[model samples]
Target chain A: MTVFRTLAIAGLLLGYAAVTSAQSAVDEIAKYRQQLQDGNPADLWEARGEDVWKQKRGPKGVSLERCDLGLGPGVVTGAYAQLPRYFSDADRVMDLETRLVHCMVTLQGMSLADATKRPFGSGTNRSDFEALAAWITAESRGTKMNVSISHPKEAQAYRLGEKMFYFRGGPHDFACATCHGESGKRIRLQDLPNLTEKAGAQLGYTTWPAYRVSQGELRTFQWRLYDCFRQQRFPELKFTSEASIALTTFLAYNANGAAFNAPAIKR
Target chain B: MTQPRPLLLVLLFVLGGCATPTELDIAKQAHEVMRASFKETGQATLDRLNQDLAQSACSIPPSTSVNKEIAATIEKENMASIRYPADGKLLGDWKSGERIAQSGVGKQFSDDPKNASGGNCYACHQMSKQEISFGTIGPSLLGFGKLRGNSEAIQRYTYGKIWNAQAYSACSNMPRFGHNGILTEAQIKDLTALLLDPASPVNQ
Candidate 1:
């Protein structure tokens, strides 16, 4: 009985080894990602967002054509690449989501509360902000990131953002730098990009605004920041807060020369 | 083969002195901006942003390395925070330890306040040979008991280290499971046994 049991265990181990060695989990995930790249779901969001942008449905019944995004006004192409820039009218640094909210409020006559009601999508409740951001960011795909920090406020935002990146807090005492400051480091299998350097910043910053397969939702850079703070064990980051804009300014400025490459798919 | 340039040295020193204040100014601004941006939610209050001396020292910019002197100071202070079991018992049921090591839940804002916390050891360690799924953030403890033996000192060291990882290695990425109130003394004992018990899967 002992011999038979031993043989059964050996056979099971051999079978498990064959199954795992056939294709490691990482390889399988990579292959899956490659396949997913063929037909990204972000394209669907882009179409939906384009419709939202052009459709006149707000209380003011105005299209967002007059809303400027650091490019004069009504220009969609290559505008996102220069965003999170200083807008003199607002006298503040604004990322794409904040700018969109501003346009929704000012142009479309939407209340701030109403505009930000559904900032993220889940299940059947799709977010207009996320879809709009996906479409707007897609407009700048393949353009080199050219975010300017020449303005005094823009420069201040960048500096503040850099500081916040290193700010440690919470029970765990983790700053963004803890996970992403070093080159050639990863947490588990997730490759943490070093946001302080050019190569890492470019790769990390430019490729975001991605379609997260796990969540099945389009995530904006603001959503990205909000979620990161949650994992960092910090309190909830207010949407489009000063710190959010500042951090976005810092990261976007660092990604100055890389080509914008999303709405891309991510695992 | 170059001669000493006293004039050049003077110029360099002046430029270096001019650079320091700007950096300090920016750092002050960053601190204020961050303070204004976050809000309290659930158990994560705004006070979490306030750094203790050890935390501030360890929170150096990525461009800088951890100062050895400061790190050592942090280690010394953290070592003083360890509270051994009052009854002096160190070992616990390794079976319970396994469960604590496997669970990665606790202390997040989203977690239930009343529920007991977990050590989440598997998130950054290979505690047992049987568990194929483990993170690589920290070292593997596959043969921990066989290698370290079940000495009284080993048991005590294991318990204390799990209680406050920073006690041994300052600024360690590992959480202060006990020191930070993330785990109970009983939970920590189970984890220590997970590493030092002869009958534990880690020993096998």
Candidate 2:
């Protein structure tokens, strides 16, 4: 562990040197990304999350051990790969974060407002959701995405998500398609994945709930949609809302058969 | 891109078997979903969900192109919407224009509504050679004045194009900066100068 820590610090210094060595912007960014992949800080969040899941601390004074994440109760193993699935209890399609929130409310006896108050973490005030998401997604690493769309509501969500992808409005008149619909397009240096197809969907959707280095936070898929809508010059996307679930369903189903690989690190 | 027809056929076949919704039905339902899902926050009101003819037409996939006659009509209508300055002065400080182009903040729910909006031109277009981070979504405007001298016709074309991009190129990815009130006539003049002024860094 000590040796790994030393190597990580040395890699950071080398990355900094590369950044200042008058390299091309793309080369510098690529080098920085390579360095980031060496030792992800997401491991830290996952560790914290495991403790949070087991600790009895909510109003009901119970751990989230009984949370049925579509793989039955208390089964964190490979549960994330099969979401945003229909839950008869919720009577709605829910992605991982939404299900987590549901469990916090139902199993922990926490108020809805209190449970959702800090969905996204700030400095030193980490979100339970982010940490929990980090741990949950990490458990599903290497599992194939198998999001089921057999239910009528699940299929409806998929169709709605498809339409929403192409829906253009607002002052900029931008849609998800504006940035992500086309192949081989980008915004500045960042490549825009065409989420309409399988390959792009696999690359884009299967690797979220990422540890964002720039933001210094474990960003969930809900956070991803929220931030994207902000850049698209649209109104704020509500966390765990139906629209978010639908969009996640579309992307997840498209990424079916790809290996789940998060909580991944991102710049 | 040629995959849309097969995809559509598959969708239709599946829907036919399952009593699934049509494209128009899905579109309407999507709008309803947006209406139910989003709330009015800061500068972004729920009314923003409403799409104009140009927006709806331009929202189609790459496999689908607008009809030529409809495209021409869109151009003509957008051309009619360009409001030139009353003084007929089409130029302003290119330095200010540079700042406006650099700023990508505005119209977001988190942004201050009272703050002046920027054109955010560099988000899509390459304006000056020095700004290596400019996006390639739009055509490069480097050496605009050097390549096309600032003739009266050229100045008018540049100003009009910036005012309402759809006027020049129907269903353009470029926003209608002036027509949408994103930038004022004065700010548009400044952007016009940014492209048309030989003294500007964009030309240099």
Candidate 3:
């Protein structure tokens, strides 16, 4: 009886120690994120992005300065907060990257291939889209997100996105909800938020276009969805595709009242 | 991409109406959009969008239940497909099973098709007292073998459940591992041992 009691006490202490160590590891990752706030590598991308916005280099020798980001012609302040909206000119809903590509094709007379060749960056082969998204999304910092479902196409996209969130297929029989439908669930040590709920949706949506320290790249919302699809073991989501915009529309619209804050740093 | 199907035109025609549409009506449209939205890359093809009856049935809004008949049909069809090992050995090396459970690789468009897939068990369940990093989507399997004695019936249930989880419970979040060829029979046996073997950390 004495030996059994002693062993039980030891086991309890061991379990308690394991829980605290795991917690401290999570807290440390959070601390790492806070430390990265002051000198965000995303700022470097933003600086280059602003330059790309003003430079005249395409076939038409025009700058993206004239592109209307759904706010008005060349009206960029807080524009990212209202995006994944319907544009009459295109007659389809578009996310910021799709709209940016549209401007490159229409306003600058650049080939679609040239414009989207590097939607994401890799070693020394930087993406113009990343640079541009960084600057444009930065312009929306401190602004409240007010994405609208007023437009019929926007409404359709939002609804379709909602379906995609719950859609299950592929080899693993996984949905986005498989990982994110409930609060406080995680995959290994990484925290997976409940994107189905309001607070999680808002938090997940507003913090994209983040500079990932692991990959050393500023990933956009399109990239986030694209990678998510990849991880979900689905086929590659086409860059700037209607499906991408639709999913983005669902998330961005769900994040209605949260302040738009990104091109932020992340681990 | 091919032209939008006649069904899409029908959907567009309906959306053109004044009445609000049900999610079921829009589900067809969503599937169509997904089919068109993805491009084949690496081993991931457009076929991944193809939904089996169980997948489609389970994808509905959480508030609704798949009608009883359909749920029973899914479970029956899946149960019919379970294949036991030829040698009748359900357990393998639990140490190897632990390694397989730790890995989350394979089948993504970015993952090499040649590489073996991992059960990614640690991503969802607490398997050991030492590994604190586990997801809560599924129940904790710590002390799983300790709770259930290693009878032949218990071993068979563990092996078969890991092989095709959907067979026992239709619309379960657990994958149809053997059915989908995500893990080989050998890997399944290892996973079974990991859950049922007396020496396995999961039982400790």
Candidate 4:
């Protein structure tokens, strides 16, 4: 009995030490984020995005100033918070990136291929969409996410997004829910947000268009989905496709009531 | 790689759905959207969108649920697909297994498909007590062999379970590493030893 008690005390000490180390890592990461938050590199992208939005460089020599972002023409402020909304003109639901593509094609006289030539950027090659998304999403800093689902098409998109969220496929047979379905879960120290729950949904959805420190690029929501699909072993998700918009709509809608805050920083 | 599944598996998956025709239609439409929205890149192809019996059965949204009855059928099919090692050797070098477990290089579109894939066991599992930074998605495997003695039966069970977790639990989140070709027979053998060898750090 005495030997067993001694062993139990040793186990308790070991467990406490483990907990301390894990806590320290988490705390260190938090501190690093706080430090990085003061001078986020997303600011550079925001500046470039704003300039491009106002520049007249396309074939029609027109700026995207007159582009409608579901809040009427050229209204940048607080527009992203209400995105993935049904557009009567397009007759479909579109997210921020898709909407930007539409504006580039229709208003700026850019061809579809040209508009979507580079949706993501590698080092030294910047994506216009990322810049535009950074500026546009930055404009909606504290606006409450209030994505609507009133129209039939909007409702359809939401339902489709819901299904896609749970759709299992690919070599790994992973769904978005596979990683984000449960609370208090981690994937090699990276905390996964439970997107099904309200708090998790809000936290996850509202913090995209982040400046990924590792990649040294400001990534948009569209990029997030594209990269997730790549990691899931699914084929490359199109730059801005119907499925991407649908999934975004679902997540954005689920994130309703939380204030949208992005063009943030991430490791 | 998996053997071509019997046609009956698809039928069982369809019959397993408790959702109404409307819900099924939504799922179908969602599938179509996915099919149309993805293009082949690197090792990932459009064929990745294809769902097997277990995938279709397990893909229940928050608003929906899976059919437990279908789980048995899925498990049976997956169990039959698990091939044992040719030499009947279930365990390999635990040192190599430790390296495999630590590595997360596999199957991503950015990954080189020509190269060997890692088990990436540490990403979602706590395999060794010494590895302080471990994931919590899956159960801890510390002292796995110590807790469950390394009998011949245990060796076979560990090897098979790692090969295809779905063979045991129909909708298990653990990847079908061996069945899906994410890990080779040799790699899986090494992983088996990592989990069940008495001298392995996991058992220590």
Candidate 5:
């Protein structure tokens, strides 16, 4: 009788294990799609961003509505796809955020220091920047990235960014290569994209200005670079510094031809 | 006869020493090896070689479980370190917060020491939906505001959690944003707004 009881228990345990294993697989797939379906919270920021763009309030009493995003002045439709391009006015290459800062300062009469100090989504002051960026990025949701690296400065920034990507340091002797240079690498269950590759670069770079669920916040490319430094145990990245801009140029150039899906939702 | 006994005892002692190293001994050896492999540089002193209590505790092999009391103590200690904004305000501009969260710069040997640090929250958690590219070390935070309305309690919790994640979860891999001074109070407030603001992308 005891032998029979043990056999029954063992059989039950085996059956339970099989069922749970199958269930877990199904659950994982469902979770992946569910994450996709949630449709990123950045949409909310995009909505508010539209309002901020049209609202006229700076010292110049002008809205960003008349600002050009590469296509033409006041034409935001599909403009993000062709950003980090040469702007004749600035006489230099500028990404979306940098261009927006210029507009906020020049057109709005806001001080560059005050505008930069506020950060992306903090205070009523910088909130407009986030909203504007979100709205502008959304207009080009389906457009492909076409960053111009032909210019000397653009090319220089790209090369500098490449150098920065491989540079190693910190107590752990880690580099960006430690986490993202190689394909098929992951920490825990998450996969790390190989930013060096075209597909990886496209997937990684084109999907910035994302909303993070864990932190419950919106993040821009500049912030993304800043965080990478922190994890590497590096000192700190200044806001919109040259290094930051250079890295953006490198990533943007690599993401050429990929769809612009900024202000994305992330897990 | 006495000499033979002593010789046999010595042999046994040597044999016992040959046994595999204990966990503690292995850890010590590993630490020593790491120390030998790295050299100190500017601002990033050798002290960083030493793991804090939380890091040390978490470093233990998975085969062993942390004692509940120790885990609770660590959590309590980390929680105590969290500091709220000087003003009662918890939320700031989600737009600026987004920049801080997305930034993965700061705290590198190559970086200028004078610059401020960043939170790099996206490295672990998925806060926004629009950013197709993100890591998943922690849970996804899409629709965080939609699910949990921006209540005062939730705002405080978000601030506290970002300030010191260990306060909420004992051995969380998340960094201590406020505790480490990686982010300022204003930065934390912006992050909070990014997370909880109805108008922020995270909520949408």
Candidate 6:
């Protein structure tokens, strides 16, 4: 009887120690992260990005300062968090960068083809766009994401985006859902966020225009989408295509209440 | 039959020596073949074929368990390579970061050589709720700031992980951004804000 009692006590002690150790391990990781946060490297991009925003260029020799970001003409503050909204002039929902392109072409007299064809952050045109997008997004740093889908077009785009997200047809027989639709999934060591959830939506949607340490260059949202198709072995998604816009609307709507953040850094 | 015993033994020995290829050997061969088959084109050059230690390690078959000692060594080596910003700032313009992450241009065979590279983060991560088109290789970073809070430590982790994912995870498939020079420091800062800033869409 004594031997059995002693065995039970030992088992209980082992279980307690195991649980405590697991919790402590998690805490240790968190603490380690904290220690490293004193200096972040992303400030350099932000500074240059701001400079690029105000510089004047293009055929008309005008800057994007006078451009309207839907809030008002020449107003850039707090515009990013409320993007993919309805635009009466364009008669469609427009995100920040696309709308900027329209402004640069129309207001600044820059050719549409020149503006669109320039690769991201390549020539003066693309650089201007990146800087403008960066500065404007920074202005709305604390704002919540509120993409309006009140318009019929907005609703249609959202639905289309949803369909696209789930549509599966590629060489690998992969769909976005195959990787992101589930919770607690990971590729190697990277954690896979569940896009269907609120927290996941916020985490997934708001961080972009990020720096890629691997490529040694800044990237835009359009490029990000295009790469997804590439990895999926699917046909490329044209820059700022209807499919792209619709998908943006869907994600924005899903992240209605989440805060906005962009131009982030990544490995 | 007794006289043939030696011959039977020799036949058994020969049969035993013919073993199947080990998983590691098979992986190595496949990697070598893949490296040899591709040629450089435009910005996408043959140099991209080279695999870092992390990639090479991951190419091997996954057994029931990973040797903890090797994993630790990989992580330590990668961690030692992480470079923090010269100045002490992690946050940047979320707007610009958004564009960078969204773009999938540059570094392709057909791409213009003059153009700058893009992060293509959306291809692997869901960043903003407003942007619907994104990939799923990595996790959704939306509300990252909100959940974890924009503490200094979280910012550091974000920067370090993005700079060299292998530092955090020995065999992570995620690319080493800083180690490979894939993005500039400014771009990294902007992306950091996108993930950790309270006002950014990710935190929303």
* Candidates, DockQ: 0.34, 0.42, 0.56, 0.63, 0.05, 0.02
- Model 1's CAPRI class is acceptable
State in Å the error of residue A24, model 1.
2.4
Writing each residue's lDDT as its tens digit, candidate 1 over A1-267 gives 234334444543554454443225445545555766776778889999999999997899999988899888899999999989988878888999899899999899999999889888886898998889889999999999999999999998988888788877677777888777877664544567888899999999898789886667779899889988987888888888899999999999999999999998876
List CA RMSD, all candidates: 9.0, 5.9, 8.0, 7.5, 21.1, 22.4
How much lDDT does each candidate structure score? Answer: 0.80, 0.82, 0.84, 0.86, 0.68, 0.63
- If you assessed candidate 3 against the hidden native complex, which CAPRI class would it receive? medium
TM-score, cand. 5: 0.53
Rate residue A53 of model 5 by lDDT: 87
Give me the TM-scores for chain A across all models, comma-separated. Answer: 0.90, 0.91, 0.91, 0.91, 0.84, 0.81
Error of 6 at B4 (Å): 66
Residue-pair clashes per prediction, in order, are 0, 0, 0, 0, 61, 92
Among incorrect, acceptable, medium and high, the docking class of model 4 is medium
Score residue A188 of candidate 5 by CA lDDT.
31
* Candidate closer to the true structure by lDDT (higher is better), 4 or 5: 4
Write model 6 residue lDDT over B1-204, tens digit each, in one string: 011233322332344243233433333343343334334444454444444444333332231122455567668988998889989998889888778887766545566758766777877677777654455567788778888887889999998988888788765546566776667788888888878877888777
lDDT of 3: 0.84
The alpha-carbon root-mean-square deviation between model 2 and the true structure, to one decimal in Å, is: 5.9
lDDT string for model 4 (A137-176, tens) is 9999999999999999999999999999988888888899
TM-score of each: 0.87, 0.89, 0.90, 0.92, 0.53, 0.51
**On residues A90-171, what C-alpha lDDT tens digit does candidate 3 reach at each position?**
9999999999999999999999999888889986899999999999999999899999999999999999998999898898
Candidate 6 Cα deviation (angstroms), residue A265 = 2.4
Which candidate do you rate higher for lDDT, 2 or 5?
A: 2
For model 2, the DockQ equals 0.42
lDDT of 2 by residue, B3-23 (tens): 123343344335334323476
- Point out the worst 10-residue segment of candidate 2 chain A by lDDT: A14-23
Best by lDDT: 4
